[model samples]
Structure formats: C-alpha cells, structure tokens
Target: MNISKEIVENVSGIDIVEYIIENDNGIAIGIINFGATITKIITPDRYGNLENMVVGFDNKSKYLKNFLHFGSVIGRVAGRVYKGKLTIDDVAYNLDLNLNDTHIHGGENGFHSRVWDTEEIYEEDKVGVKLRYISLDGEEGFPGTVETKVVYSLNNENELEFEVEATTDKTTVVNITNHSYFNLSGNFKENILNHYLKINADRFLPIYKNGDISGKINTVENTVFDFRKGKLIGEDIDKKLEQLTFADGYDHPLLFDDKIGKIELWESNSGRHMEITTNNEAVIFYSGNCFMKKTPFSKKDKNRRIALCLETQNLPIGENEVFKENSILRKNEVYKRTTKYKFSVI
Candidate 1:
C-alpha cells in the first residue's frame, strides 16, 4: 500500500489536500483537509454496484457556503453545552453560541473549522491517514490546551475504523467524533422508514432545556424511544411527544447497557448491514432532524429525512455527573476511544 497526497485547489481559493487510502478489494476512501472532512467513501452495492454512501458537498466552496458539517471530525466538545456555559472547579465560563440559544459542537469555532497537520501511513495490511490539531486554552470557553488526533483507517475487512485520542493541559472536557451524515442505502429519495435498527441501550438520557435530564433512565417497552429489539426507524417519528416538539425526533442520547456487545444496522434497500463496536458506555443515535431546519448547509429538503448519524461517543458534556457518570478525565489520565463500523452484505 503506497499512500499519496495531492493538492487540489477549490473554488474558494482554499488549497485542499486529498488523502487516498486503497483497500484490498479495490475500494478507496478520499479525505480532505479543508475541514478535516471525509470527502468521499465509495463502496459496492448489492449487485456489485459502487456508490458514495456518505452525504457531503461537491467542493470546498459548498462546505464554506453551506452549513453541513458533512463528514468532518467534530471536537473540543461534540454536542451541546447548557446555555453556552460550563462550570469547572466551581468556575463558570461562557462559550460562543452557534446554535440559537445554546453552544453546539464546541461553539462557533470548533475543530471541524480548522486545518490540521496530516500524515498518510501506508502498510501492506492496512492504510490510514492521521489528522492532528491542538486547541488553545479558552479557545471555546473550555479549559486547557488540548492536543488531539484522529486516525481514519480502511482495512481488508471493509471496516472503517475511527481512532480518536486527546490530552489536555489543565482539566478540560473533551468529546470528539466524526459528524458524518450516513445514508447507507445510497438512496436519498425516500425516507429510511424501512431500515431496521438495533441498539444495546436499555435506557436513554432525555434531553431538556437548561441542560437537565428530564427523568431517570426509562425502559423501552412502549415508549417511542424504544429501539432495543430492532424496529423501523420512522415507526413513531410523528407522535405528539413533549421532547419531540422541543428538539425534534430522536435527538437524545441512548444509554447502552454494560452486558450488551456489538450494535447492528440493516438497510433493506442496499442490503448493507453495519455493525458498530466500541468500549464506551453510550452511543448517540442522532436522526439528523436539525440538519437543514436548524442550521444552514444541509442539502436535504426540510421535510425529507434523508440521513442518519450513529455517533459513537461518550455522553455529551461528560462533566455532567447526572447525565453520564465516570465521564470526567482527571489530570495525567489518558482519554481514548475506538469506534469501528463494519460493512457487510445481507
């Protein structure tokens, strides 16, 4: 495996660098540096048809002009912080409010909006590209200058392995992940209402305004949040629930039980099945309802549920003791998590 880097000029005058990784099956994935984003990931369909499974912009200007985080690595703090503020050691700090009344994705200037140092590592067995960046103290109203690295690897097993690591100077909160909107079926025309989904979570954290959990972990018996037994994704998306009106459908985090193993997803259209395995305690199943409705850059029509994000991460703002326990990483402690998504044909 010989990895190569090429400089391609986008319309926005930003010189974008593309890193190509080739797998044994002749499949390849292209990543860009403009936003530390996944430019393209080409895979085969049921009939050996190749298509791009991830949603993204066509060029660098679309990424700049549009608001789609696309397939970029998000960081500092991946999800929302209550009211654009967080308290550390009895001290409160204010962050930039990008999402209306709250701070989303590490405020207006997160790691996705920056350029990182990249290196392409090649090997006969596997190939990957590593993106590294450092955040200064108080950059997004968070403590410590954090050094972070994200490695994107594609192997012979058809698994996309995302390895994320970070270390902080002072004790600052960190939750990094790839904000890639996935339409695994490769058919964006219709909603993914027939897609069968299963999660190991018996409980979920209900999100509310002012950064508070609505209640304790609830059972998934008849509740709309139930996905434990593999149900159609859009089965109950339109129910008149209280949280649905506040954050839209399925915007909360799913709490995985300790006894559960790998999570599975089956796409009826493409016959593509995906399995996710991680060492973390929880996985956030974001339905992408806020894609273009709340923000700007999504290429989707407001009414169409075009994409879904299975973001495997530690709970949002791990500093919140009630929301996620044992999430705080102290000084001299290393924070590491690996999320692997394997593709298979049904």
Candidate 2:
C-alpha cells in the first residue's frame, strides 16, 4: 500500500489538503480534509484500464460550493428532519430548514461544509486517513458539542472502509453517512440506468411530496421498490407510482432485512461490481435525479441519472417515534458505525 498527501488549496488561511491512498492492485482513493470529502476513486475495469468511479469536482471552488454533497460525509443527521423539529429528552429544538421546511443533511452549515483536522494512518496491510471535526453547540441549531471522528482506509483486498464515531456533550440526535455518487461505468461515460442493483431490503420508507419521510414503512413486495432479485435501475424508475414520482427517482430509505447481507451494484459494460456492507439498519438509495443543467464537472448536457448513492445509516428520525428514539445520542454516549465498499471486476 502507498499513500501521499498534498495541499490542494487554501481557504480563509486554512490549507485544504488531499490524501491519496493506493493499494498494491492499483486502486487509489483521494480524500480531502475539507468535509473529509472523497475526491476520486480510481479502479481497474475488466481490461485493466483504470478510471474514476465516483463523481467529484476537479477544482477547489466547485468543492467549496458543493451543493450536491458529492463524495462528502453527511452528518449530525443524514436525511431530512420533519419540519426541522427535533426533540430530545423533552427539550424541543428547531433546526435550520435548509431544504424547504425540512432540515436536511444537518442544515446548510452541517458537517459536509466543515473543514476537519486530519491525521494519516499507516497500517501493515492498509493506508488511511483519520479526520476529526468538532461541531459546536447550537451550530446549525443543533444542540450538543459533537466531536466526530471518521477514518477512511483502503486495503489491498479492494476494500474501502469507513469507520465513524461521534460523541456529544448534550442529549441530541445524530445519524451519519457518506454521500458518494458512484458510476461503475467509470468517469461518467454513461448514466447508471443500465446498472444492475440488488438491495437486500424487504421494506422501504416512503416520502411525502416535499421529500420528507412520510412516517410509514411499507413492504417491497410486488412494488417497483423491490430489488431483492436485482434489476437494471432504469427498468422501473420512470413508473408512474406515487413513490417513484414523489422524488423524481429512487430516493427512499431501504430497511435491510436482518437475514440478508450486503447490497450489490454492477455494470456489465465495464465489468465492475461493488458490494456494500454496513452495520446500519437502513441505506438510502438515491438515483441522481436532481442534477443541474450545467454541472461544473460534467462535460455534456445535464443528465439526472448519471450516478447513484448507497448511503448507509440509521433510519432518519423523521416523525417516527421508534426511529427517533433509536437515533438519540445521550450525553457522553458514543455513536459508532462502519460501512465497507468492496470493488471488483465481474
């Protein structure tokens, strides 16, 4: 394994450094201290051609204004909070409504926009970076001074792992996940419509018209949401079902079946495949349904379904009492989770 670091840019007198870790097999991943964001993931295709498999910007300005949340660590809470209202230990707090009336992705000043303190990790079989961020009390209207640490490591086995842990000084709610837009075709050569996806989920959380969780969980049986057998993403994406139309595409939290194991994604054209394993109960599958007309990275015209995200995390604490209760992080209690993405050629 090999690792290198360089200063990408300086923002407000703080140096934004990028760390690139490569395995012996030639798979390399680049991450920056800014947002602890992943800038690139280059892997080999069937014919031994190396190409980027994730969506990212090339310059610092685009990353500084990364509204898409591409390749960033999403936190405090991963998904939308209903009406921006969160209550913990009988104390109600109103969070910033950055997305319509809902507080999404920890508000506008959330973890994705923060610069983290970083340290390098050199292991016998892996090379990695450990990033730390301290979210002050009342930042983005969320209580508690949260000290978050995220370690990203790449090993020779073609596995990229994320180890996340956080602690808060006050009672609060927290759900964290990585928002990495993946395209197995490599470098966005084509949209992900042809990708085959299998999610080991028997149920999914529905969303309202405004994209907030509807506080209901429905079985995937006989619905377009069913991916138990694996199918092309474009097969039923445009169906006129209420769930499909509500979010323009797939953007729901899939409840993982306890007996089932990992989620799988594959692209035959490039012969690339990925397996995702997480300790979290839910994974949000977001088809890139909201790409802008002129994105800073894309060379061609706007295309919505260019990539997809498998955001593994605890279910969002919407209006669901059970989920909210489970998402709570009491004072001095630690919140820890791990997710791994293993890549290979099919």
Candidate 3:
C-alpha cells in the first residue's frame, strides 16, 4: 500500500488534510482529518473501470457548506437518545437535541464537527492514518473527558477497515459509527433501490417519527424489514408497514450475527458487490428519506432512496436494555470496535 497526503483547507488555524491510501489492487481510499471522515473510495467495476463508490464533496469548501454527514465518523453516541436525558452516577445530564428534541449523533459539537489530530502510519503491506480527538467532560453535556483514536486502513485484499478505540476519564456514553451513505452503482446519478441486499438478522427495532426507537424487538418474518434471504431493496420498501410510514421508508436496526453476517450488497448495473462485517451487535439501515433538492448534501436529486446507510453500532437509541448495559464507557475501560467493508466485482 502507498500513502500520500494533501491539505484541502485551512480553517481557524487548522488544516483539514486528506490522506490517500492505495493498494496494489487498484483500490484507493481517501480520508480527511476533518471529522476523521472518508471522502472517497475507488474500486474497479466488472468492466475494469475504476470509479468512486461513496458520496462526498470535492473539497473542504463544499464540505464546510454541507452539514449532512456524507462519509464522516459519527460519535459520542451514534444514535438518538430518549428525550436527550441521561442520569449517570445520580447526576442528570441534559444534552443538546439536534433533531426532534432527541440527542442524535453526540450533540451540537459532536465528533463529526471537529478536526482531529492525525498520524501517518506505514507497514510492509498496509498503510493507514490514525485520527485522535479529545472530548471535554461537558462539551456536549457528556460527563467524560474522552480520548478517541480511529484508524482507517486499506490493504491488498480490497478491504477498507475501520478500527476504533477510546477511553474516558469519567463514565460517559459512547457509541461510534461511520456515516457513509453507499450507492454501489459507482455513482449517485441514480437511486439505489435496484441494488440487492441481504442481512442475516431476523429481528429489527421499530422507530417513531421522531427517530427514537419504539416498542420491542419484532420479527421481520412477514415485514418489509426482512432481508434474510437477500432481495431487491425496493421489493417491499413501499409497503404499508407502520414503521415504513413513520420514517417515510426504512430507518431501523437489524440484528447482526458475525457467524454468517449476510451483510452483502451488489449493484445490478455495475456488478460491484460489497460485504460488511463488524463486531457491533446491531446496525441501522437508514434509507435517505430526508433528502431534498434544497438539501445541499448531495449533487444527486432529492430522491427518497438515492443512498442507504449500513451503520454498525451497539444498540438503537431509546429506552432499551442494551442502553443500560453497553452505552456507558466506564473510566479505565478501553473501548474497542472494528468494522470492515470488503469490495469485489461480480
């Protein structure tokens, strides 16, 4: 693997740089220091033509203008919190509610909005960039002075891997995930409804209009959320399901089993396929339901299902059992998680 770096923008005495890591197999991945985000990912199609596989802006100028998290790493808490309330260690912490009065993706000044310190790394077969961030104890109403490190590495096997590690001084909530919207058709000129997808899980968490997880774990046996056997993303997206109506489409969490993940996706037009494997127990599959023409998030049209997200994380945000158990990162406890996206051409 080869590594190169360039400064894309200078903001407030900070330089937002992009690092390009290329492997021998023609797979190249681009990451930016601002937000520790993935800016570009290039892979070859079946016809042997290379094209970018993720959506992102051209430079830091466009990045600063667009608030939508294209390929950035979401953190502190990746999903919504119930009513933005948390009573950890008998002290109530009121967080900034970005959407619908619920604390979503860390809060107003989340990890996605900061420029992290970066270190370039080199090895025999792989090169990577390590990004670090220090979140103050009460920056976003969280209790811990947290230190985080995320490494994005591209290797010869066409695998783009994300390894995250963090430690907090005082006990705090932490759930980190990459917010990369994928349209495996090589580009976003068209919607991703025709793409085929299959997830191994048979149960999913339902959601409310406010984006909070509602109700218990429901079976996807007879629902549109079912992707156990692999099916076109559009097959049941328009069905008259209650959850579908609430979110305008699919915005829920599907259980994950590493034994046979089934997190496989392929574009019929481009013959580009991707498989995701992760250590997180649940994943949020969010269809781009809020996209609009006025929304500067994309150059693509304001389509309902243009891009879909597969965010692997600990648990869905709401009042849940897992929330009581996994969300809190205690002091001296090192938190670690890994998610990998491997690419190929059918």
Give the number of the best model, judged by TM-score. 2
TM-score of each: 0.89, 0.97, 0.95
Candidate 2 at residue 18, lDDT?
91
Best by lDDT: 2
- Which lDDT tens digits does candidate 3 get at residues 1-75? 799999899999889899999999899898998889898888888998898878788756676644667788888
User: Candidate 2 on 78-158: residue-level lDDT in tens?
Assistant: 988888887777778899999877789988988999999999999998999999999999988889999999999999899
User: What are the Cα lDDT values of the candidates?
Assistant: 0.72, 0.89, 0.83
CA shift at 295, candidate 2, in angstroms? 2.2
Give the better candidate number (1 or 3) by TM-score.
Answer: 3
Clashes of each: 1, 0, 0
Worst 10 residues of 3 by lDDT: 294-303
lDDT of 2 at 141: 87
Worst 10 residues of 2 by lDDT: 293-302
TM-score of 1: 0.89
Ranking by TM-score: 2, 3, 1
